[model samples]
Target: MTKNILISGASVAGPALAYWLHRYGFTPTVVERAPGLRGGGFAVDFRGDVHLRVLREMGILDEVRRRQTNMGNQVVVDADGGQLAKLPASFMSGDVEIERDELSRLLHERTRDHTEYLFGDSIASMTEDADGVRVCFEHGEPRTFDLVLGADGLHSNVRALAFGPESRFIRFLGYYVAGFEMPNFLGLDHTGLMYNVPGLGVNVGSAGGKTDGGFVFPSEELDYDRRDLDAQKQLVARRCAGAGWEVPRLLEAMWAAPEMYFDSISQVRMPSFQRGRVALVGDAGYGATLGGLGTGTAMVGAYVLAGELAVAHGDHRVAFPRYEERMRGYAEGCQKLAEGAGPFLAPPTRFKIWQRNQMYKALSWRRLAGVFDKMTTKAARNITLPDYRPAPRSAVPRESA
Candidate 1:
């Protein structure tokens, strides 16, 4: 039986789910608000063992490996912009460091032919019955589907429609973050430079494709609305007002830059990842930040969801429950790590920041590796996948060929 699957958001998790769903003989339609593929941003990585295995099974490891950013080491500077210390890139962005948007585009390209991508559209309402789900779109005509998945983001439309309001699930991590592209005026090479004002702020710029520099300002609590980009920009501008070392210049460029991304640096914690036929796969369900295992969890969640659905014969009740059960532990662990990173990235106090920096310098690579190994091993062990055999050759339809 062919099942019609409606996937919201076309970034990482949506396209990934579509890829596996298509391979499992289900038809997937992805709806994205972005008119086209979004390009450029900080690098994201696939750490640990299981996530790498997912990439390998998906047959895109080679492609992703080839396009990795490989940004090398970073040089940290003090408040006066004097060199403090340097660390390897692997520590920051993990083993594979590809530009975040690049990975999204590559994953989208892989499912382009197999999935129906509806750009510049969003779901307005979803009403589900025993038969199927009735979906009303912001642009397209109303339709029905066997199931709907929300990979939209932290403020997921599907989650808002299906679950309660976002405030119920989203936990503020007491920080605000913004990232945008700028000119390579710093004339940096593949190396990255970071200037830390200790607890006040931290600005990082790296020479890479499509990304010139990024500014990260830690805040106690943010008041600006997330949907208002203009206000968000003003918030960032106000926070860094009269700052030193090319900050004013960067702000000027930021005012003109077409693409600006901002968020509250929070995590989405849910008692359950799914309710009824509505399921959330990625950031919508659990997101802490780039530092958290959210990316890895999303990749692994996509794999498990699709695999479970395939094994359960498209029964969301069985598949969705199993998917959540397999991923909840890993998601919680990632969220915890991301929470720690917020303080570690920019400690709350100057004394604490100095102590953390000293610790980072003192820690040996072997010790760091041991800590990472424990994290990865624990996360990887949370899942137990079924050996679902492939369908018989005779079951393959000629149209699918």
Candidate 2:
């Protein structure tokens, strides 16, 4: 029997899981709260051989490479925009970097014909029994499926509904981040400029004719409406009110930006990724915000989850446990990478900012920097991916092919 699977969130993990599930003789349906595929967000990278292998299996490696950001060295700038130091591209871009929207579009294109997509809707409630899970959507009719997976990201609605409230699983790392689009007024070309002050930092970079601006600041847990865009903007403005460098202009552009992304820098550490017939994947399961190499891990998790299900013949009781066991260590290592990112990027005091700048200068020496690179490479390649043969080609529909 072909098990029916419902995946929430049409971002990286959802569509990737859909592609693999369909290939492995399962019926997969994806529901996204967005009206359509999202566009224009931060750039994400894939590092080491493990990440490349999954993209290769999906047959989108060459396409992703073609669209790679190709970002060059990043310039650390002072208050007067003077270059304090230059950081190598390898330290920032990794092996391959692509815009988040482009990655989403490619994954969606790959699986659109094979999977059913329900946009402009979200899961409101869920009930599970011995046979399957009954799910009700905020904008659509309730339905039941053999299994339900949450690939819905850090603040996953599915995780909240199925497991418990987000507070049970989230660990805040003491920072918040916001990013939005702005005109390439600085005329930056495949490069970026970063300015930092005590407890606050901003980076503005351009790629493919537009600039991406980001703000990161140290903060305790904040109280704000997650859905109110205007309120979020005001908070950002207030937090960044007296920042120097090009921040004033960036703030103006932020207010005018068509859309913005705002969230706390945190990691999700669940005791187990599966409960009953429902399971979580990607950031919804084990994710570290910002610098955590999450995109690659999410893709890897999707591949492993689907492969295990196929290996277990679509039995969640067997497959979910196996998946979690195999992924736990790797996910924890990836989550650990986020631990120092906030303090490193936005130091709490001016002396600490100076200390970090001096450290970046020391990294200019190849031997000193190679150590950090080796650490990242080790974390990225920690898991040995199991080779699961593709499902029989006969199971694939002609149109999907």
Candidate 3:
């Protein structure tokens, strides 16, 4: 019998999971809340060796490299936009930074041809039976699937339905982030300029990568509503109200932008990423925000989940437990990085900011640079992928519904 899997969210993890699930002879249907593909957000990176190897196996590494932003330099500026320090772009963005939407588009395009996609719809209610799960959609007919996976981001609807409230599993890193599109007013070329004021917020502007730019507002807790867009916007505006150059301008631009994203920067933590027939992949399960290992971990999770399912021959009892066992330690390591990085990202005091700058300056020493690199790479290399060969193409499932 062909196994039917319902995947929620059409972003990075959903489509990637769809790709491999389809390849492994399972039927996968993706339902996204957004009416269509969402575009325009900050760039995301894939670091370390594990994620690179997964992309190579998926036959998308060359394509992903071609789409990289190739940002030139990163400049730390003062209130007046005067450069305080200029460093090579790779230092902050990563060895390869690509626009987040472009990567989503690539993953979507790759999976759309083979998978079933239901946009502008979401699961209204879901109940699991001895045989399978019966899911009712907010906009579509009810159906039953063998399993459901939430590849949705930090604020996941599927998670809310299955696990308890998001607050129960999310650890807010005391920050609110907003991203939107606007004309490159700062005139940044293939470079980005970031200005930081102690206790205030950080505002960044870049143009070489995408037409849109955004800002980050770090706070003390995730006190705001995750769904209330207006409230989220107000929070960011209030935090950076009296802030330095380009911040006011960016806030004004955010007000008029058609598609804006605002959310608390939080990492998802669960004693177990799996619950019965429901499992979570990517940010929905363990996200460390935009700059952390969210994207890379999501990619790695997709590959591992699919491979494990294939190995178990569609037995959730075996596959799901094995999946969590294999991926949990690595997820914990990535979450730890987010905890250590939160303070540096949102320095609460001027002394902490100075200390951060001093640490950056010390990296000029080759030994210090190597130390940081190894530290980062060690976290990045946490996942140990299995050597499950692909099932024969003849096993691919045919459409039944």
Clashing residue pairs in candidate 3 are: none
Query: Candidate 1: which stretches are off by over 4 Å?
Result: 363-401
Ranking by lDDT: 2, 3, 1
Q: Candidates 2 and 3: which is better by lDDT?
A: 2
Where in model 2 is the C-alpha error above 4 Å?
A: 390-401
Deviation in Å, model 3, residue 3 alpha carbon:
1.6
What lDDT tens digits, residue by residue, belong to model 2 across residues 1-401? Answer: 43899999998999999999999889999999999987656889988888888899989999999988889878899989999988888787888999888899999999999899999999998899887889999999999999999999999998999889999999999999898889998889999988998889888988766679988998889999987888989988988989899999999999999788899999998988999999999999998988888999999999889988887778788789988987899988888887988898888888998888888888778997888788887888888787765445333212111
- Give the lowest summed-lDDT range of ten residues in model 2: 392-401
Error of 1 at 173 (Å): 0.9
lDDT of 3 at 180: 82
Pick the lDDT winner: 2
Q: TM-scores of the models, in the given order?
A: 0.91, 0.96, 0.92
Per-residue C-alpha lDDT of model 1 across residues 1-401, encoded as one tens digit per residue: 43999999988889999999999999999999889877545677777567777888889888888988767777667756676666656567666767778889889989999899999999999999988889999999999998999999888999999998998989888766667777777676677776555544555556445555566657766666765778878988887786677678778878877777777778998888998888999898887764776767788888888877887778798778888887888788777777766666667676876776676555436577467556745654455544443455333212110
Question: What lDDT does the true structure give each of the candidates?
Answer: 0.77, 0.88, 0.79
